[model samples]
Target: MKLRKPVIWFGIAMIMVMVVTGVVMFMEKVNVFATGTALSDNGWKAHFSEPLAKEAITNGYVYVTDRDGEKVGAELVLTDKGRTLQVEGLQPGNYTLRMEQKAVNSQFKSLKKKKVDFIVYDSIESISSAADLKLYFERAKDMQSVSVSEDMAGSSEKATMESAKAESSDAVGGGDHSSTNIQVEGVDESDMVKTDGDYVYSVFGGTSVKVIDIRNPKKMKVAAEIKPNDDYYPTQLFLHDDLLIVLGDKMVRYPKRSASQAEIMPMNSLTTIRLYNIEKPEKPVLIREIGVEGYLKSARKTDGMLYLVTNVHPYLWAMEEIEGDALRPRIFDSNEKEKEFMDFKDISILPGAIDPSYSVIAAIDLTSPKTSQLETKGFLGSSDQMYMTKDHLYLTALKYETSTNSRGAEIMIWNPGRADTEIFKFKLDGTNVEFHRSAELGGTILNQFSMDEYKGNFRVVMTEGNMWDERNPSKNHLYILNENMELTGSVKGLAKGERIYSARFMGDKAYMVTFRETDPLFVIDVADPVNPTVLGELKIPGFSNYLHPLDENHLIGFGYETSAQKNPSGGEPLILTKGMKISLFDVTDFHNPEEKFTEIIGGRGTYSPLQYDHKALLQHKKKNLFGFPVSIYEEGEKEFEVDFTGAGALVYEITPDRGIVLKGDLVQKKASGQQYEEWETQVQRLVYSGESLFTLSMDEVKSYSLDSFKEISTLKMK
Candidate 1:
């Protein structure tokens, strides 16, 4: 057929385009996956649906490029059975990652390549203005709507002066004076027991606060029982002059959409505070009550002001768009007619935090009337650990994203890689809370005991390591941050193979215990905040889960006794914890710390509340008395079978010179083989008033003579 030159050329071009498009579509069959949009300065990671051959990945299979499509020189490695890839040496900026899958499954012969764009941040960026925060929230709301699979569900403060006065009387008085074994001397930690010469205020059964008359220790009686709403569970209590404050959490459940349909998670925790007028012990009156949306993270009382912290994870998934007003946390005051939502102006967000969670800090005046106001500051993050000094409140939140392929292909994803902790500091002055500064640090903080402020510098101890990386063994770190939350000095690279079990900072000296197969008690000198030094180390047979300072040079270690077994496959030794272990560490000589005295109790499964919660430890240093709850687990004939050897309080006479001497065991009598009964008694706390020592359980309170450790009286709580 005869045709014009232009028409013939157009027909040829169309045929060429169709052929190229078909080839491109076939080559894109293998999906290259990127876990998240954000990358850390450390590096970026990518994943693939199927494993890749090592040779294929090495020969430029995965690489990152800048905006101009120019290849960036970097090191790429395959992990997780060659299913995951990581790229390092990239700076903080936007970059496009190119991942090429050269080999497909045996069933398919074609392979494809994909590219993804991501941003690597140098550090957490705080919102500069309200407008910026609102925009970030909008983006977060939209991103959250795209449901991530359940297998990928990896979502990761201050001292007050009322404490200053309380510190002066921390020592055990001669006749009947005793106080809570607090982390810091003058800093009063909220506990179940608060004594004022004649009466004892305690939290009982998590359902009510009990006030007992201790004037007659031989015949202790319940003076008053203060109960809150049905949904509230009282956990801790604080007392100030004529008032008693109860701290707890209230869980609210909602009706399901349909009776046949399963209900959502029932418990929505809200931080609740209840103040009672205890002037008349027989008739305690509820003076004030407040419920704020969020689970209580931690709270402290200082200088007559109560600093309360709560972390709220809002139900933003149910809504299409992020509601700015709904984000503000709600608070209820007894004086108010109804619960009121906090003003948006009162809420503040730090830069670099793009998440929608709320970290609310509220300061309440203890002396204020029922109509008193509360000062609150809210940030957009979730605080896991709180460390508060006399003048400042520190909120620490660990930020991390789930990398499913960090480990091999398993249905369940484990939290691997180390987390970056975002620390938000707030200055405290009476009833006012002013945001001071914010900074980011590496590793995860254990608890409040993991942090301390000395000489205007904050000292924090954290364990650093990746669960997936065997080369990066867990190590403890002592980071010294100034008042501005900037790192000034650090004592890193400590206990390479072990993680920090417990840490305590006492003035110029710090004591830390790390464990793997055994315990290594390290004594670090912070006399120079800029050049902190580890003076001595004491290796013991067990790990100390908590460190309590006895005096200037003495420390009490509460933990478990563990034995090491050689791995049959010739890998690292496996540590097998056996029983409750308490060690007395003498650091009188900084060059040589010694575990002078050790106490091992029960058998393979013995458990003690003291090993987990510091509040469970009761000690009267001056009286030379220490005690904690013990649930003896005696061994049986079979490996799995265990015999419960009655639970009770184990008391000891602890002294610098005499060491730990068992005074007696106040055993709670119960029927055999009965795991729990109507009046099941598991001793949890111990306190002393006058010449009597009191042991507290969930169902009853028993008193004993301090001098002879003889049973005196019993008060039952039902």
Candidate 2:
């Protein structure tokens, strides 16, 4: 997961006094970026140079950092063509590096500041990685376009003079040399897990967990390491049967315009719950991990039943133990009605109604009045719940209204087999539910859903609607019940922004998978169990998140391509887009559904999809071709391009074998499987048994060999 370079952790005499006080004291360090210099609307062309920058033009340059904003002391060099940035030994205070004062070509210009303090052992130095790769090509000139290839550092093919449109537009034409996205702030990472056979698992920081055994995918062996003495980590998980359910420290969803911003998740790591017990194939037994008492964030489990939904903590720990010792944080227990939290900020609702949250985090204080420790400025937060079936633990609740205008909350079905009860709460009768603020372009607005169904009846199917109103979707509310609990009634007009990620009823029509501007597969009728009618929709361009039904008239839609584009020559492109079809479609004409087949998986042409979230989407069709495990990095410098997502969680299986680069049956040679491979160190999640595969590398647990795959020993999780 590593890639967090704010120079590792900022502070080299406050970045040599903000880069020698922004160029000897502001007056010439405005909006600077070099490689070729950027900030163009057409006023700063071709940015990518080292020994290249005299065709000069700049209203920016001067930088330094270390308060968590690395790039210290002096650096504004193009050293004849190799670029240079030697900022002395470092040790300063006030700093600078400002850019904003452009009318020359307007890409935006309105920021400037340059403060100084330079005083480390005779003045800072050292900026050579090649002068920090030439100020990262002048901050990749306005950052974020990622490969359009004009020469983009040569080598994706295109330097020929043998023109014929140079192969019709310099290498495939849609144009992109692939490489850019440098928020470079600690190497932009979130998930990493790759295994066809040889073990690999990851879940880092915010807390930690690891395991590895590359089984010779070339070599990497580290097996075993899981820490949680009680600090909080593990944000998402699901591995039923042998039991291994973990989901901690969350901020998973947020956009319903501040869903009551409190960012909860901390009390003894959310009441601490690790619970491992891998039925020992080679040894995996944490035995029993239970840290009971509410506030637990997101989780899912079936064939065992454990539905949960809680963040009701408003108790404030007996008055911070009588004031003066005031601390915060309360882990595991979003269920059981437990309540005693302080702040962690959580507000997700994109499928409908919920908002409020903008900077609030404080939770800490496990069980015994554990002395002082609550220094939160870190902004750690969490939300989003679903424990599909292991007894049904669903979540989404509201009741802290701030002004009125609708969408408050109510939808939290828990039934861990009764002993852990709550069972019902659909909420939303309208007094005026407005809840705005989550339109970050397509993410939060309350749209929870559930269905793994062993016998079918109804585990969950949430909603909130008005998703820009796409043809009246029955308005909202469709709770259908069955797992022997029964409700089977209340499927009304739901078509606002369509929010039921999956429903597939069929015997009376149910389809579902709704969204507002994209991601559609609607088709409702519920056989009229109460009032469910929409009967036709199917958009599909990207954003279905997850869906599979196969029987009942054939239905399967994985589609998920994120958005954001404008280049004909307008530039601002930023795509990471991943998750493509296995599609199939044939809803027996849900209003005309007949596609039959399509398959194209993995990064290609991506121009705008800002990472798309809700854990982006994973699969559990058990096996028929469903994938979600990624690791694709377009990586650094074209200026603000930042596309190195660490790349690795890729669980591929949809192969009748046509091409993604295979053919090693054991090895006759042709193996390109397109793997991510960028590890120097850092892996903390991956699980799968039977054919073999397991991982975690903060300490232990490594086994592998799904055929010819490698890596064999290293157990410990206990």
State the C-alpha lDDT per candidate. Answer: 0.69, 0.34
For candidate 2, the 10 contiguous residues with the lowest summed lDDT are 159-168
| Model 1 lDDT per residue over 1-718, tens place | 8999999999999999998777765543443444333334335665554566677655775668887889988777877566566777777777887755454433343333356666666554544454655665665554442323232223321111011111222434344566665655555678877777688787767878888887886777888887765878999888887888889988864223345424542456778888888889878888788877798877777767788889887765444445455456777777774647766566765534445678888878887746678777677666777877778888886643322222322111223344456677888887677777776665777677787787788888877664325644566689998877768899988988567778777788887877777788888888887899999998878788777667777877777788888889998877777778878888899989999999988777787767766767666766688888888876679854667766788889888899999996886655765653233467767878777788877777788988898898888767
Among these predicted structures, which one has the highest TM-score? 1
lDDT of 2 at 337: 28
lDDT of 2 by residue, 321-420 (tens): 1221122223323232244333322221122111211112122222211222222211111234322222232233221111101132111111111101
What is the Å distance of residue 128 in model 1 from its true position? 11
Number of colliding residue pairs in each model: 19, 147
Q: What would the C-alpha RMSD of candidate 1 be, to one decimal place? A: 8.9
